[model samples]
Structures are given as C-alpha cells and as structure tokens.
Target: MARGRRLMARDGVRPSYDPAGPDQALRAALQDLRTGRWMAMRALLADTTQWWRWTQRTQILAAAAAGTDVVRAWLAEEPGNVHAAVMHARVLVERALRARRERHRRTHELWIEAWDAAQSATATAPRDPVPWVCLLALAQLDPEQRWEEHRAAAPEPMLPPGPWGLLAEAGRRDPDNREAHHRMLQFLYVRGGSGRLAEAAGYAQWAAGQAPPGAAAHLLPLYVRVERYRRDSGHDAALDLHWVGDEAAREARRGLHSWFENTQRAERSLSDLNHLAHALWGSLQFSDASRVFEAIGPYFTPPPWMYRTPDRERAVEIFVQARDRCRAAADG
Candidate 1:
C-alpha cells in the first residue's frame, strides 16, 4: 500500500482546530474592501513597515478582485503611496498571469507595466520589502529581464542583479518575509528542468530549516512536491505522497509536525494552512488533515489545491471530498 494509505489505516492521531487570528483579520479586511469600506483597507495598507504580511494578503486579494479602481484611486490621491503602488503592480502581475493561461498576447505588456510600477514603488520606498518582493515576482514572470540582463542594459541599476539578488534584498529588508521566499521558489519552479526542481527543493529545505519555528515557510517542500508532480505527470495524475524521495518526505513530515506544534491557527495564512492540509491528506494523516481543514474553513487558495485540478469548481470538489474523507477517518 502507499504510505498515505498505510498511515490512514492506523489510528490515534487527534484533531485540533485553531483558526489563525491574523488570517481572520486579513479575511475581514478583504471583506471590508469588497463592501466598499475603503478606510479599513487603507489602514491595513498604511503600515509601510508591515509590508510582508500586508503584501501577501494584498496580492491574494488583488488576484481575487480582478479590478484595481480603488487601489488606483488611492495611488492617484497619493502618488507617493508605496503601498498602493506595490499593490497596483501586484494586481497587474496577477492579471498578466491569468491572461497567460488564456494565451493572451498582451501578457508581456502587462508584465512590463507591473515591472515599471514595481520599480517606482521600490525607488519611493527604499526600506520597504514589499516593492522588492513585487519586483522579484515580476522577474519570475519575465525571466528575460532578470538582474543580469537588466544590469548589462542599464547604465545605473536601482535593484539588484537578478531574482536571487532581489530575493536577498527583500530578505535583508525583512528576514522572514514569507512572500519573498514563496516567490523565489516559484521563480525556480518556472525556470524548468529536473535540475531546477531539485534546486527548488533544496531551497525549500534550506528556507524551512532557517525559518523561525512555526513559520509558514515549513510548507515550502510541500509546494515543491505539487510543482514536481505537475511537471512530471501533468495535472491529472494521482496525488502521490511519494513525489519526493523517502528522506525528503520524512523531512517534510517532520517540518509539518513542527509547524503544527508551533503554529497558532488564527495567525497563519490560509495558503499556508491549505498547503499543510493538502500535504497531510496526501500523507494519510487524516486526523491532522481534518484539523487543518477546520482551520481553513471555506477559504481556498488556488496554488497547491488548484494544481490537482485546474478547474476551480473541480478543485473545490476535490478539496471537499478529500476533506470529508479525512474528517470521516478522523471521527471513526
């Protein structure tokens, strides 16, 4: 039997549900924005120092909204608004990514606009990591414009040499910036080939190892597994717990358990929890998976879940089915 199936057959793992408070706050903020309460969203973004957390939530929200009028208005009112500029750039990048899926020819143009906006934001707020994170994301989307080529082309460069350098700069600004590392992992993944995947896994392992205990970076390996599965077998392949080697699997499980021990559910990102829940389900730790499912509630991030099935409705169905099965096993 597969490792997950074997694990599922054994019982005794208890389930615990603790909703991440910060995630809840983010959700609330998003809801407020959706309802036209600009003050709440403005206050959320006004904290330039809290860029890491706000940026992550903002990008997720921007992707979901698919419109940037409010954010654009904020930028228009305060042209020097670093937060607004970064978010606008993120929204453009998000749209560009979506367009790429439809084979839109203007995807590159959107990316360029995002890059320019990100550059402006970085220049305006040299100390903030959010703009750098945005730039790193743009670099990933448009690999041709990474540090090396940009350096060779520009007489004077404001940003660092490449995506690696951009990531390093973002880390320097905020050492434990979850979004920066996530973007780096993504950049590595898109730069395809087995060697890059291995490197990505190594990076994930290293990041997880270096992160403070209970941080969301612990799920990096799980993200790598999803990417690897997609690359190797395409989207429709069976979800394999053994996508990584045995040793890597052990490390991921160890990291997941560590995260579970240290994490406060209400403070964790939905994406992080979703990734953990998916990983647990894949590993056949149904009880543990059930706990994460409860914490996640109804919110679903595209990433690891959507990778299983590109169709949104289908992805939700798969998630609900897996979640139900895991809950049933835990209850039994």
Candidate 2:
C-alpha cells in the first residue's frame, strides 16, 4: 500500500465494479457501487469514459477516505489532464494544511509543491479558458510580478479570432449561450484589472439576464460575486429575499460550502476553497477564513519557503499556523 492508500482501509469500504466491460455495456457501467469490491474497477480503467467517471469517484471517494497519494499517482499518469490536475491539487492543499496544523512541517512541504505544479498546469493549456481562469484566480498570488508580466506582453497583432475570441463574439451573436457568456467573462477576467474585472461583471449580469427559470442555480453564484464586489465597492448586494431569491441564495451558499468540504477534484476543490476563504476573510469571517485558509495555505498563501516544498500537505499546514498566528496577533 502507498503512503496515502492507507486512507481507504477504514470501515473496509473497498472499491467495486459493475458487471460491465469496456465495450459490451450500454450503461451497465453506471451500476450502483457496492463496498468490499476494489477488484471490480481494475478492468474498467482501460477505457476512457469509464476512466473519466472513475476519475471523479476515485478522487472523491479516495480522498475523503484519505487515499490522497493513490489519487495523485492516478492523476500523474495523465499529465496535462486538467481534471486530474484539479482533483490532485485539492487534496494536496487540504492535507498539507491538516499536516501543518499538526506541526508536521517536513510533511507539509511535500504537498505545497504538488499544489504549485497543479496551479502552473493551467498555464500549460494557455489556449484553454479554464487554465487562464485558474491563473486569474491566482492573480493576487504575485500581483506585482504577475500583473507586471501580463502588462509586459509584446503587443501581438490582433490575429485572426481564436476560440476565446469566437466565444466572445458569440456572446454578441446571441448574447445568450450561457457558455459563451461565461467564456467572455473568463476572457475579461484573465485580462485582469479594474476595467476588465468590471467587464467580467457585465458579462455575468448578462448571463443572469439570459438564464431561464432554470438558470437560478448558476445565476446565484454570479450574483453573489457581483454582490460581494458591490459591497466591497460600497454598492448594494440586493437584500431582496423572494421565495426564489432566498432559495437560490441559500443553495448557492450551501453549494460553495460543499465544494470546500470536498476532498477530491483537488484543483477545483482547492481553488474554490481558497476563493471562498478569501471571500470570507474579506467579509470579516476571520475564524472561518482562518480555518479554511489554514487548510490549503502552502498552495494559496504568498510565500517563498511555502512554494519550495514537495510535500504540499506539510507546506499548507505551516501556512495555516503562520496565518492564524498573524490573524490572532492582528486581532489581539
């Protein structure tokens, strides 16, 4: 068993597979998961779709159970695999902080390095909006350096439209493909700074406008960020609480919390958690932010020694302790 594989041994919940093979099954793969059957999934890994779904499960199930290292190796085989990068990073960040809280500095460093690799993975797929969005989320990480780099880009020709440009244009075409709308939001966000940031907000509002009654699920989060920004800028976060409005807001809050609580899908989990914590910190939820911030610090916090380690788990914990102490001192 690997270092992290020991996580799943608890309660003897073994991974199981269905009565489906790679080709012969229509939807047999979706069969319910039964415990004490880790051998079932072995053949399934040879396929792609099955692999993808398995990826999700392996991450969530394995990580929550504590088989984080197993998840890491699984993700490693698929380098440049965005999903893997995201999932693995989430675990590294979380476990790192947990380690740090326990004062296991050496182990924490191991995880932070993993988190950075995942963060930089987004840059590998520069053409993809997802990666750029990842970078944007990290803008505050090295604001002076990153902003300077973005600013220093050579003025390349306004070349023929790329996918990102097309997505931007599509928003104007129908002004309604929720996806295109988000694509535009991503573009403006990656562009960074106040002007582009506001433009992203505009696109988000446009998305809200186009979302049908079914759009509330997606719209609420957009609105929350918009609301948060508005509040920060002294604008109003509409306190209106209609039945739909209240429900949407409530669900959005829960969804975000659930995202943070998740152990797998490392990159996304870490990213979302970091964003939530920062948002919480900004909102003065010091204690809540402190816990979350500690949970994934080495990856998210701005520090050199933090970025130096391979055991991201250990690095994160150190970050947590330092941050909490700093916060404590500030409060004191």
Candidate 3:
C-alpha cells in the first residue's frame, strides 16, 4: 500500500543481518555471551518455552559462544544442566562445521567430539529436540556416510539414504523441526551433482507434506527452488520463468496458507520469512509478498537473497527493489 510505502520510507526499513530480530532478550543474551558471560544466555534459555525459539536461540548463541569458554563455564558451574549440555553440543557442532569450512585438520576430531556431546545430551535431555538437531548438523560433515546411522534407508526409493534416523529423532522430540530439515538439506547439497537437486526437492516435498499448520516446514520447497536456481546456469529470462512457474506459485501459496497465515509474527523464523517473501515476490504474488515483507520488517538473512547476486550490495538492492515493488502493487 502507499501507506505501507510511506511508513517504510518514513521509518527507513533496511535489511540487516541482525541475529536477534524482535527479541531483545536474545539480543542481550548474545551480547553477554560474546563478552564471555553465560548468565544472560542461561536465563534466556530458561525462559524460552517454545521449542522452535529454543532451537533457534541455542544455535545462534552457540555460534557466538563457540569462540569463548562461556558454555564450558556454564556446564562447570551447573553440572548436569540440560540447557548447558545441549548448548555445549551445539557450540562443538558449530566449531566442527567451521573447521570443515576452513579445511582444518582437526575437523574430524571436532565432529566426533560434537557427535559424542550431542549423543550424551539426548540422554540428558530426552524431550529436547536441540540435541537431535545437533546430531543432524554433524551429519553433513560425514559425506561418505561412514556412520551406520547416517546411512539409514530412505523412506522412499527415489530419495537417497541419509541421516534419516537423526531427523526422525529430532522430529520425535519436536515435530517439523526447522533446523533439522535444513541440516538434512545441507547433507543433500554435499552429496553433489544434479541428483542432489532431485534429492533436495523430494526431501522438501516430503517434509512439507507432513508439516502441520503454522510449521516452518512449508517453506522448504521455496528453499529448494532457490537451490535449483543457484545451481542453474540459465540466463535471466529462463530464471524468471523458473520463479514464476506454476509450481513456484503453488509453493508460495501453500507456505502463505499453511505457515504464514497460521503463525504469529514474533514466532516466525526470520530466514523463513525472507524465503517466503522472496518466493511470493518472485511468483508475482505481490499482495501476499507485501504481507511477508511487512512481517520481515528489517530482519534479513543473506540466504535466498544472496543466491540472487553474489555482491552483498547488489543483493540488498535486489531485496529492496522487490520489497518496494510489492508495496506499490499492493497500494495500487
């Protein structure tokens, strides 16, 4: 709407990589963790009741706390604390993944340590899905599928065997766990080749189908579409067609209905919101995209947008253009 545009312009709504969006408590907790303090992280995790929020906050905090001894200190101060134990696994997994990215010689050792921590956390915090998600995170680092559990048979013949057992454990603890599905997709990507796209797409559809109303799982298809686009070497015209295709539109609509419409704004994943907005805008569902853009506010994840352009500034420009056009269309 023109009103929406004016409000956005007046407020200068810009994209940011703010780890804590609309959650001041998380922001403060992250700050404290960065300063090597664990109390705020401790309190925040204690107060976070929602599984999705718990999973998200722990992963974010783990990333920030990985370089410090905050998690270790917390564990030492409160032995057998489930939150600290799970977070220790998360930080170790984060370190392992980072080591893998950097081609560090210690990657395998870190991965094994992370796996052990996560496995221990599962016993300590059986009802919490974060530990299972932590194990799923490690699944990608083992591309050879060396672990028997990682080579579990796929539910459908079309899909490849992967860490389905880890995913199932996460789902058992928290159905439609967002990070768990994404971790599986990361493994599929590591599998490499055109076949990876099919695996990812099939996996996305399977997950989306089982998703309940208000679950972030509905956005999986949109992410797969982006992955496909990223893999394709097509020109602008072909890429445009890919985005506005029947299937793309259908996925966007399903996400809007099954997830966006049913979930509260504060509860939505910032990454999921960005993907939904990107898909809706790409599919020419401007009105629907406008709503998603509004929900996104200033919180923007690099992903799905960065897939458009490798240049950070260009990606931001593209994001802003799509958002403005959607707002204008809704207004008209």
Best by TM-score: 3
lDDT score, candidate 3, position 229? 87
> Which candidate model has the greater TM-score, 1 or 3?
3
What global local distance difference test value does model 2 have?
0.39
lDDT tens readout by residue for model 1, 186-208: 66665532236776777787778
Segments in model 2 whose C-alpha atoms lie over 4 Å from true places? 1-68, 73-86, 89-116, 119-136, 143-200, 206-222, 229-238, 241-332
Q: In candidate 2, how many Å is residue 201 off?
A: 3.0
lDDT of 2 by residue, 1-332 (tens): 65234322322322222222122231232231233232223233334343224333433333342333544554656665555555455455446545644768565374446447545654553333332332332332222333342233321232211233334333333333333333334334444332344445454444454444422223324333633343343233432221135444443444345444443433233333444444444344456556654455334432221332445555444434435543674566
lDDT of residue 87 for candidate 2: 47
The predicted structure with the larger lDDT, 2 or 3, is 3
lDDT (tens digit, per residue) of candidate 3 on 1-332: 77447435723865678989888999999988888899999999999999989999998898898888889999999997888899999999999999999999999899999999999999999999999998888888878878888889998788899899999999988888899999999988886322478789999998899889998889999998988888773455577776888999999999999999999878898889999999999999998899998888888788888878767666766788888899889999
Q: Using alpha carbons, what is the TM-score of model 1?
A: 0.76
Estimate the TM-score for candidate 2: 0.31
Candidate order by lDDT, decreasing, is: 3, 1, 2
The segments of candidate 3 whose C-alpha lies over 4 angstroms from its true place after superposition are: 1-8, 192-195, 233-237
Tell how far residue 279 is off in model 2, in angstroms: 20
Please provide TM-scores, in order, for all candidate models, with all chains considered together: 0.76, 0.31, 0.94
| Model 1, global lDDT | 0.67
